[model samples]
Target: MSWTLTEEHLADLARGAALLGTGGGGDPHVGQLLVRQAIREHGPVLVLDPTEVADDALVIPTAQMGAPTVVFEKLPAGTEPVAALRALEYHLDRTADATMPIECGGINSMIPLLVGALTGLPVVDADGMGRAFPELQMETFSVYGVPGSPMAIAGEGGETVVIDTRADNARMEWLARGVTVRLGGVAHIAEYAMSGADVRRTAIPRTLSLALSVGRAIREARQANTDPVARLAEVLADTLYGHLRVLFRGKVVDVERRTEAGFARGRARVAAMGGATGQLELVFQNEHLVALVDGEVRCVVPDLVCVLDAEQAEPITTESLRYGQRVTVVGISTPELMRSPQALATFGPAAFGLPYAFRPVEELVPA
Candidate 1:
């Protein structure tokens, strides 16, 4: 089924993206407003079903590359993605017939929507990571052998840079991070130009709908005076992400954060609230990567460790975490593609320099 994006759906999309963001992809507030602005000016953008896409059609992925904190301060000049897309089109020597989100998370989720509105291109109802990951190379496209090159990145100042790297996808991220930091800590990136056939195979299908459904479920649950957490878990059970488990519910006790090498790397310590004993600690580098509960490693990436407000159920990003905030930690399984051997080698806990063997959250947690 095809759907047209209207203004009313914006909130649900933002909320859902934040949930899938798993504590990274930056705050969605700025992005929500930007997408709303674009929609209002350009009319409703069409969201195409993956099956509707032509195999030979060109597809482009667009996202902001940088620290979420700096993005808040600098804001988008609105034209960054356009410039990046134009540059990528020039380098690729082809116009994109459609656009897709690099990942389904927070601000990044909204970027592709806004681009679709601005460019009059349909936004594919799919994304790279079923959940957000910190680095460019972490996308399933890279794991599936897609190159991140001939890439175009644009800054707030309107300068555009095209990158061509064959060293490795990690090197692509490394070079892009360096450029992004120099571009004032945040820049618009358009890369992984591909055929619709490849995108249809590699993209996490229906994630946009998945985000909206999760968000709408929470909204309806709240209105109906039900348990939003349980409702959300039930909502997720029907999606590509098989389940969402409550990892911990507590008040934040400590947060160690630093903007090192242009990435927010740190941990959040949450102690059980409401007289419950013990604590849960989350390790993050932009997004939550690991969860250790009561001294046991309960969940790790490529699985998602999402942190939401205990009362409201809104996700809290790594940079936004602080002492004393009440939060509920939840975990979701990564997309099946991301759990493959190649995917694990690229984004597993061990890939993050953590000494744990890669294990799916579904396997690590009781069924």
Candidate 2:
């Protein structure tokens, strides 16, 4: 069966996308607004099921690669993803059969929907990384041995780059990041060449549904005057690594950012609330990478770390974490699908320059 995006689905989609983002997918607000705008202007989006795609179909996943901060400021040229997909098609010597989201969190989820509308291709309901991550190679594609390079990157000016290299995923990350920075800190990317069968096997199926469910739960709870965050926690409680922790609730007191090798490396501190009155420091690079309570590491990468407002429970991206803003830090774990050795190597603390050995979030948190 197929699914179509409608005006009614926007709120739930945003809520669910935020939850699935596990606190890293960037903010879903702009994407949700853009999608809602598109629906209002052009009507609902046509979503095709994976089964509807031909077995040998050439499916390409598309996403925005860069600082989520830039996205909110510059606003896409509106033609970047279409241009990226066309560039990939030109290089591949075949038109794409369908386009899927690289992931369902934040802007990446809505990007493919816009691309599908612009290109007249059906948007597949599946996604690569069921959540979001900091780099291009963090998807299931890498876990399944798919090459992230030889991929296409495009800018609003119609300029495009086809990255083909013998280097592994990390090196590809280094090169792609440079290109992204050169393109003014963000560009559209389309990668992961796979047949429908490979996609069904490697991609997380029904992620849009998961996103919708999570979103709907938040909206329903809010309408009922219930605790939205608690309700969201309940929806994901079973699938997540362990009980979610309300790591810290406070107001941002400081922010420090520096550009290192094309990544926005920085840390922000928030003053805690109520019984826990202190500062919580969060280290980040595009995505939140670590959380520390009073200078001690409480949670680090490969475990989900996100910041939300204390009252509303909406996400606040790393770039948006500001001084004097009240927020709550939420910690969840990467799903088992991403806990494999290879997965950990790609995104664990080691990958983010932290020296500590990796441990399951369950072991690190208090019982």
lDDT of each: 0.87, 0.76
TM-score of each: 0.98, 0.90
Q: Candidate 1 residues 1-367, lDDT tens each? A: 6799988998988898988888889888788898899999999989999899999999999998887767767888888998999999988788999999999888998998889999999999998899888899998888887887878999988899998996377888988899998988889999988888988888899898998998898888889989898999897887778877788889999999888676788888999877889999898888888999987888899888988888888778887898999998988887788888888888888789998887777777776
Error of 1 at 54 (Å): 0.5
Report backbone clashes per prediction.
Answer: 0, 2
Which candidate tops lDDT?
A: 1
Model 2 TM-score, all chains together: 0.90
lDDT of 2 by residue, 1-367 (tens): 7988787887778777776665446567776776677667767777877777787888898888887667667677777888888888899888988889888777788888777766667788888786777787787777877676668999877899988774377677778889888898878888887788878777777678778877787678878989877887787776544456777888888999765654556888888766777888888787777788887777777777778877777777666667888988877766676677877787778877887667665566764
What is the clash count of model 1? 0
| Segments of candidate 2 deviating more than 4 angstroms | 22-26, 40-42, 48-54, 238-243, 259-261
lDDT of 2: 0.76
Candidate 1: minimum summed lDDT over ten consecutive residues — where?
358-367
> Model 2, poorest ten-residue lDDT window?
236-245
Alpha-carbon RMSD of each model: 1.1, 2.4
